[model samples]
Target: MSIHRLIVKSAALLTAGIAIGALLAGAAAAQQKLSFLAAEYSAKTLPFWEQVVADFEAANPDIDVTLEVVGWNTIHDLTAQRIAAGTMPDLVNTATIWVPEWVDAAAIRPLGDDLVDATLRADFVPALFDKGAVYNGENWGLPIAAAARAILLNKGLLAQAGFDPDAPIATWDDYRSIIVGVKEKTGAFGYAFDAKGVRAFRDFGYYLLNNGGTFFAADGRAAFNSPEGVEALQFLVDLVKAGAVPDPLGTTLEDYQPMYEAGRVATMINGNFAIAGIKANAPGLEIAVAAVPVKTAGQTPVTWGVTDTLVIGKAAPVEASRKFIAHIFSTAVRNQFDEAEGMLPVLLSQAGNPAFTGDPNIKAFIDMLPTSQFDPFHPQYAQMQELVKTAMQSAITGAASPKDALDKAAADFNALVK
Candidate 1:
């Protein structure tokens, strides 16, 4: 070959190599990074998120996602610490109650119609999405996990107490009779009452709502100390007085699982997830689920519907984070998540899935969705919940009468609202 031709070919090769390197560098620079802080719902929570991230990354090579799963107990503190340090994650899974606080702090961005299209928004269970994810006329988060509360009865214990396990408890009076009977006959605690922890207010809430009580009146004043509220608390206090529950002042909902599994308690009010735990820990135990008893036979039955949501940080790359959110909210991914966590489906599309419909436990909870109620969304709900817990504890431990305890709580809650 001629020397000139050889020189030209070599120069052309060098130019091509430089162009290729520049393109590779540009691709790396264009890649978007998203960090997700997820609450650990169970042991499977981390593994499930890991698979999701892997799958998302494979499909969108230009967007990289980092996932960190923490227990429900610690996720709030961890998120707060991150926020204080100015290192907030791009996405966070949090309880719906906390959304108001996060919104007030301007920590998260409202998910407008542009981010969550009409089709995707329509797919969510309307009751859950409207009640939980929407705050102040705007959608602020995506409902990721949900559970409906129910009464879980031990068939063996009820039978031993001479009550048919299949009998429906249509009124509070009937429920009281059965629990009292179980306590007197079987010597097992009739009810597993939880009165400790941040969520202890839920125990009282069960009775409060059933008896036509609301935490706050329409005018935003504290109304939990009304006649109905006092009656509800008194009923629970009487149960404690009658020794129908064990250590009402000391036990949290989590504490009741083992006792229930061991057949030490006749009945307990808990979410559908508890059914999964009981079955896994005590496979031989016969469990019966029923609607929470109401104040009267003709009154409607109400159950607590709780949901945890996904929110995007204000500083996040909104477009990329939204893509990740959309991917996880897909019916296929959501069905797996709900099944693994023993939670009801938050998406309407999953309501008909055979995996959920075929499972009687899930069906029981699902059946209660029509009458489900959620916690009031207030900026100071956490503080209000603490006040409610303290009031219940005070009443249960004889520090004060149910009326006085609730009155004090109501006064304190009103002060906060003002």
Candidate 2:
């Protein structure tokens, strides 16, 4: 064998090895794709998620993303069904309320040290994260948006009643007096409530908390039978009996908006999304918001704050899905998401951004976060709401006593949890 022959053979082998390595790298890049499932198959979910995807893709240049817009109606149930059928997406959007149940079911993975940003964990509200991610002592998801139900008071009506328009009704008694006085002076309904439904009662979860009771105990037992719970329900019921609420017209959260527009109802309790309807219904009406009035003299006021969370499903390709989840939580992407949806931002710094700050009504939702309680953490919360709704309907219609109705509800809920 000649020296020239040996040298040529070695060079050829090295060149082939490098070409193979390049091919493998190219294939790996092509195979990396992240998929997301969001509530509402509409522009609200996609535009924001896509913005983040675009930014991430530009920076990485090697990953592809697919975004699926899911409707709120069936997203959670469908996601679970699909995962059971072996076809879950990489990531899913769920109400933060479900974090406990989902994590308990072992239907999701723990996001370890890999994806969480220390700064975000520190800067973001711990309560928000505890409600959204830390369930059963584990972090399961990222809180995307923070929202609370607020009392939408008619400043015009308060003024007509000779009350201070700028001062918030500080207690349940104050709210009652103001509403009754307004109706007497204006010939309008004192308060507009969801006359025949559960939201009126369900919305009182805040009142329950402030009064020292929860819909469910941390042990998953029904706690609505407590005195605080009964008193909360009676607060709304007494308002009805006093002719404060309009005719038991069997209304909903949406129904009261029109009444306010017609100058027939003084105030109502609802969420940030309700602002659009109010503005449209009563463009000229002076409106303001405040926290739900506290139930007791010493009780700290609380409100129902809902969160939309991003969770990686059990069937997700955990490593790749986490990268996409973490990417969505980036500061720039979060601001874009809240701005597009008209939702209060979750990032501590972006809370007061002019884009969302222009509406003071939104601030009520953001402000309630400190004393807000997430929905009952039971997996069967939907069932519990239904049972409570039924019981309250019976109670309001004289078919049962509030105490009896709630006692029965507690029994039913206990059975469900069992």
Judging by lDDT against the true structure, name the best candidate. Answer: 1
Cα lDDT tens digits, model 1, 101-171, are 88887888898765677888899988888878788888888888999898999999999999998888888
Which window of ten consecutive residues has the lowest lDDT sum in model 2?
A: 195-204
Global local distance difference test of model 1: 0.87
Cα lDDT listed for each candidate? 0.87, 0.74
* Model 2 lDDT tens row, 1-418: 8999999998899999999999998887677777777786235666666667788888766667777777776787887786677676777788776666667667778766566667767756667776566766777877877667888878888888888866876788888898788878988887776645545556556567767788888788888879988887787677778877775547875677788877888887777766765676678988788778887577777777788887876666656665676677766777777766656677776755776667777765676667777765677877777777766666777687778888998998898886
Candidate 1 segments exceeding 4 Å error: 1-27
C-alpha lDDT of residue 52 in model 2: 73
TM-score for each prediction? 0.92, 0.84
**How displaced is residue 162 in candidate 2, in Å?**
2.6
